[model samples]
Target: MDFVNEDIDNYAYDHTQIEDDLLWRLELETYDQLEIPQMLTGRIEGRLLKMLAQLVEAKRIIEIGTFGGYSALSMAEALPDSGYLITCEMDPVAIQFAQRFFDESPHGKKIVLKEGPALDTLKTLTGSFDMAFIDADKENYLNYYEALLPLMRPGGLIVVDNVLWGGRVLNPQETSDHAIHRFNHRVKDDHRVEKVMLTIRDGVSLLRKR
Candidate 1:
């Protein structure tokens, strides 16, 4: 189910900016300890997240799923001195895994770990965020978008991960793929924002709210 060609992806990674030592350690440890290490965002997507954060001049970031904390750390590294990041994860084990690395990194202080259903955590949060990243349960993609949209600062960015669902979104072979397809269609039709869906990693949709 590789949406991206391995040769092309590897070549791109080889040519792109290298990840820092902390991220390299996290990447290695994830493979060493986790059953589903692939869930870690890896290098290309992680670097993209950091670049987006920098471009947006993000002072505050909200991450819906903090699997292994790679994405959170990537974005956190780009944040200014006063910037902050909030990452939500429901799995206790995953939170623990992410926390260990977050604690070790200097960027960890800027990250707030919210351990609960992302929707519940989103509801309790106040104030608009500069950027939001959604990569959690696929079934609730639209719901997450709706919940986060109103809380996003005007013109802020919202990045959704796994929109392609490994090319299955085109055929929609399963419930999750079907839902992701529907979500893609929903975003495509939204008139309030400008969106670009990229074939990066699995798939990434960037929306800038108007």
Candidate 2:
């Protein structure tokens, strides 16, 4: 189901710099202990997230999913002294593990973990956000987009992960694939934002609110 050729993917990983010692250990531990460790963003994507946060100079960030807090920490490390990242996760168990890492790190204070349905929590947030990372439920991709749009400032970036759904998106048979395909189509024609789908780890759709 991988869209990219295996050799190319290997080459990409080889060319990219690996994460630092602490992050590398955290990522490995998450995979060893968690049920769905694949959900955790690894070295390549984590660095990409950090770089994007830096590019935007994002002061206030929101993450729809905080799997083991890997991505949250990655972005938080890129933030300025006053920047903050509010990350929400639906699973209580996952939240606990993420919190453990957050508490041990210097950037921990900047990360706020809200445990509950991301959609419901997002609806209650009143302040504007400079950036957002959406890696939650697949069926609610569009819903998440709509919910966050009003709160995202113009020129703000919203990155949606797993858009390719492990290459299932290219197929018309799988239900998840169809859902993702439809979501991609919906965003393509939306007038409120500018977007491009990048073939990152799992295909990330980067949208800029207009």
Candidate 3:
């Protein structure tokens, strides 16, 4: 089901702040080059990630999925000079696509790409992070959240993408949809953090550790 009116979505994009040149190129290139271009964070959602990183003054950020690098670059640009970002992706094509742009951006040095299962990567990672953005396989949402939670510093933020699963979360007939619904429920019931789910694009759940 359509989550929001197409006309309103178009109007919001029209009135919102536009993307920078590099981000614009990323958006276009992803559609042109990638098979699943819709996974691209796009200008609007990318901007939101950047703003959130800046708002938290995040020094260390971790991203579970690195589809074409749009979201990683967006948040990396807002990072402080010494800040660093670690993004994990299972696809080789996505890793390469993202690296090409990451190497070009001024914030490129701030990003570290890990190509593997996000759950495994999280296990190997050390130290607490200021923020984490989860956009990986829907089936592992709860696993990623559980593994990453201990790695987050107190008051750190966690941004989960596709929570509504294109509104499929309502009935959850498919495997992916049911997984998202369960993940959403887990987050809502967890006492360690407070969360708000927003209907942005597919959907986004922003959680802050308490």
Candidate 4:
């Protein structure tokens, strides 16, 4: 499951920029109160999200999942004051939990959490996006990719999380594992986008619409 050694992961965490106070509190509270706190983006991945947003000069961003609001907040922090992020979430519990943290952070104002099915939410969205992050249900990863690719501007980035699915992607058996494997290949075969898969925390795939 660990793409890198445990010691290397720890070293990477130690060397990466420390998460800000709000994010630190969010991380701690998520572990304390949430059922699957591991879902939080954590330090390294959060920093990567922030940097990716900045690299794209992202003013308009769309996020498919708003777990504990950590990832949304990280990307939103890179946005200019006028820029905004629209994040879709179907779970009422997660929405409530993430909304609380969104309210407390100054960057939260830039985030608009859309409640309901991500596919339904994606349909309602309009305009080109500079960047997008997909970290929702594994079963619909391919569907999300198809829906989002058209919305991204040329050169815009789409970040897909949990592509490795804890290494289940290698010899996929469960429905979710197969779904992720299928999604990865779908992106690989698509000529419309250039893709690169990173072995970071459960694996991350970066797809740039070409």
Q: Highest lDDT, which number? A: 4
Per-residue lDDT for 39 in model 3?
88
Per-model TM values vs. the true structure: 0.97, 0.94, 0.97, 0.98
lDDT of 2 by residue, 161-205 (tens): 998888888776876778788889999999999999998878999
Query: Is candidate 2 or 4 superior in lDDT?
Result: 4
Candidate closest to the true structure, highest TM-score: 4
lDDT per residue for candidate 4 within 1-210, as digits (tens), equals 568999999999999999899999988888898878888888999999999999999999999989889999999999999999999998788899899999999999999999999999999877699999999999999999889988999999999999999999889999999999999987888999999999999999999999
Once model 1 is optimally superposed onto the true structure by TM-score, how far is the C-alpha of residue 155 displaced, in angstroms?
Answer: 1.2
lDDT for 185 (candidate 1): 97
- Per-residue lDDT value at 44 in model 3: 79
lDDT measured at residue 61 in model 1 versus the true structure, 0 to 100? 96
* Residue ranges of candidate 4 with Cα displaced over 4 Å: none
Compared with the true structure, model 1 gives a TM-score of: 0.97
| Superposition error at 117 for model 4 (Å) | 0.7
lDDT of each: 0.91, 0.88, 0.92, 0.93
Q: For model 3, what is the error of residue 114's alpha carbon versus the real structure, in angstroms, after optimal superposition?
A: 0.5
The better-scoring model by TM-score among 1 and 2 is 1
Off by over 4 Å in 2: none
Ranking the candidates on lDDT from highest down gives: 4, 3, 1, 2
